[model samples]
Target: MKLKFTLLTLFLVLISALSFAQKSNNSQSIISGKVNISKYHSREELKNLDKGELLTLYIERIEVIVNILPNIAFATKPGVTMASLGIPETKDNKKALEENKEASDTYFDSTIEFQKSILPYSDKKDLIAAILFYESTLKALHTYEDFKKD
Candidate 1:
């Protein structure tokens, strides 16, 4: 009986130590900061992007910007258009502009779904930044390139 008690005590100590170590590691973990848009907008790399690639990069930039910003009030209904944080929009031609807007909206909705799906598993700081930056930059590059031609 004494031998069993000693073994049980040892096991409990080991479990306690492990639990404490896990908690400490969790406490030390840090989240990544938001991406800087001004830096990306000024980047020379953007000048070389073609229409399709520019669109993709623009969307990616938007995703990164969303991740870094405060949680926004999105619509509860699917397919509903929500306000952009603060970016201004100009419609050069109504029909063409609306079509472009619709495509952009669809992309944003898809991004929200994608973010929700993978965010649960990611913990690395750079991985999170990559996800946000790639998505946002893709979208931004697309829209800006289109607008520039107007």
Candidate 2:
């Protein structure tokens, strides 16, 4: 009887595994093909994207900004010069960063209000592209700093 019970459990587990199995097709991915910076960053095509695609971009935008937070610390690091990081001591970059920060804050508050009000998903492609461009700038800055250290 114990052997029979074990066999039954094994069969049930196999059945459950099959039920949970995802499609094996690579082209049918919900988020589409290989995600990268090369993808077109235009807002005019937002409506053309699937719900999954928009959500994925939204998540990516958050991740990119979060990765950039350390750059703020980079500014305060001892012995790290602005020229080394390639962050020019200019009003323009600071102004752009401040604008992005305020936009980020507004986006956060708006997300909460949106959910509460049951609003439809707003396409954030423009904001995502802006943040991505900012992040790329940070990456270039870090790379410059690394090369300068050598």
Instruction: Report per-prediction Cα RMSD to one decimal.
Output: 18.4, 17.0
Q: Tens-digit lDDT track for model 2 on 64-125?
A: 44434444445422344444567664567556655655665576567646543542354455
Runs of candidate 1 with Cα error greater than 4 angstroms are 28-48, 71-109, 112-150
The runs of at least 3 residues in candidate 2 whose Cα sits more than 4 Å from the true structure, single-residue gaps closed, are: 1-40, 75-150
Best by TM-score: 1
The worst-scoring run of ten residues by lDDT in candidate 2 lies at: 25-34
Model number with the top lDDT: 2
Clashing pairs in 2: none
Alpha-carbon shift of residue 3 in model 2 (angstroms): 55
Tell me the whole-model lDDT of each prediction, alpha carbons only. 0.46, 0.50
lDDT of candidate 2 at residue 76, scale 0 to 100: 22
lDDT over C-alpha atoms for residue 94 of model 1? 31
